[model samples]
Target: MGYFRCMLRNRVSLYLVLAGGSRGNGDGDEATTPALALGGEGGIVADLISCLEAVLEEKSGELAFPGLRQVFMLNNKDAIVRRAVRSDLAMFLLSGWARAREERMDRYIKSYLDVSWTPVMSRLAAVAAKPATVTVLRRRRDPLATFNSVLENACSAQRCWKVPRPVLRHVLRRTVSEHVMPAYRRCVEEVEQPAAVRTER
Candidate 1:
């Protein structure tokens, strides 16, 4: 998990490098967030894929669902954690898109993109919660199934929706459950998934 997390950050850095090229710095100026800017050509996406290639070259381990992950983001996650999380998250996002395209689910599609509460996330949530009529016609998606269909992958189109800034700031926390965030809070501070200390049982 830690390595994957670092790789994500490093991948972003590598993307930055590619986007800007090796440039000279001013004596005391700060580097601006080039990736944060939207509506550009989205070159970081290419850099991100390049970073994933670099990471795979460095780390050699087998995973159950590399193919499915290529469809999502690269594997910046534990299989267990990711599979669990995906059960809910990916189903909603992907299925919604499919329904919108096929059955002309225009309203849900708009809500999915133009959400006000949590912005895009809320939109995705709404799309996920749509009645079966929306999804029953499209296709059967297990949502948790590991996909091995090797198609070309890119972070554009379906994967490139940006969260509106105001709504994003208001609901920036990843999960609503407070206990979900810091499992590392320690030593008399409570933690939900703390490492078990050995005791003479």
Candidate 2:
């Protein structure tokens, strides 16, 4: 039974990659078009969702295959595939699969945010903390510039834009609480502190 389940998981993962047009090797390359000819078709989308649901419903008491989930979560390079997967996942959640897997879904969203936003936030934080050169000072002086730039780029990303409205709202709420608020607080403290004190620290 264990071996059978493992084989089932491997098969499902392969199907997910092909159905979602994700690259097989997990490089950051653009996702190839699914040769299954399942681009944005409702049937293929439903099948993908059903497969994911079955995996989530397993009695193992843990997510069966995280790599497969990551593939589904991050496969946004192709427009048709992105739309189909995004819409289908959203519908699956809305249709009540999320009730039992709420924590799992939250984890997925957090992982997505970590992947998509963490680097941008880290870079901005580094720029903010640097010696107050002309360029860095300009950015720090008007933090809105930094924030808006990040927001614009995030909104433009395929992964961010493809997220469903409800899921996006949840993501924004978490982002505000977990990242933006803390960062904004630090920025304010830094701006208000005397340069001598900051330098001393």
Find the candidate with the highest lDDT and give its number: 2
Indicate the TM-score of model 2: 0.42
RMSD of each candidate?
22.1, 16.7
Assess each prediction's global lDDT (C-alpha) against the native: 0.32, 0.49
Displacement of the residue 32 alpha carbon in candidate 2, Å: 46
When summed lDDT is taken over every stretch of 10 residues in candidate 2, the lowest stretch is 73-82
Residues 1-201, candidate 2: write the lDDT tens digits.
232334335655645655565445466665333433443433343455546545544532352332234324422212222343344233222243334344555565667567666756775576467634424465547644676677667556534343444554565467646875677667656655566776686
- TM, every model: 0.17, 0.42
Report the C-alpha displacement of residue 55, candidate 2, in angstroms: 10
lDDT comparing candidate 2 with the true structure: 0.49
lDDT of 1: 0.32
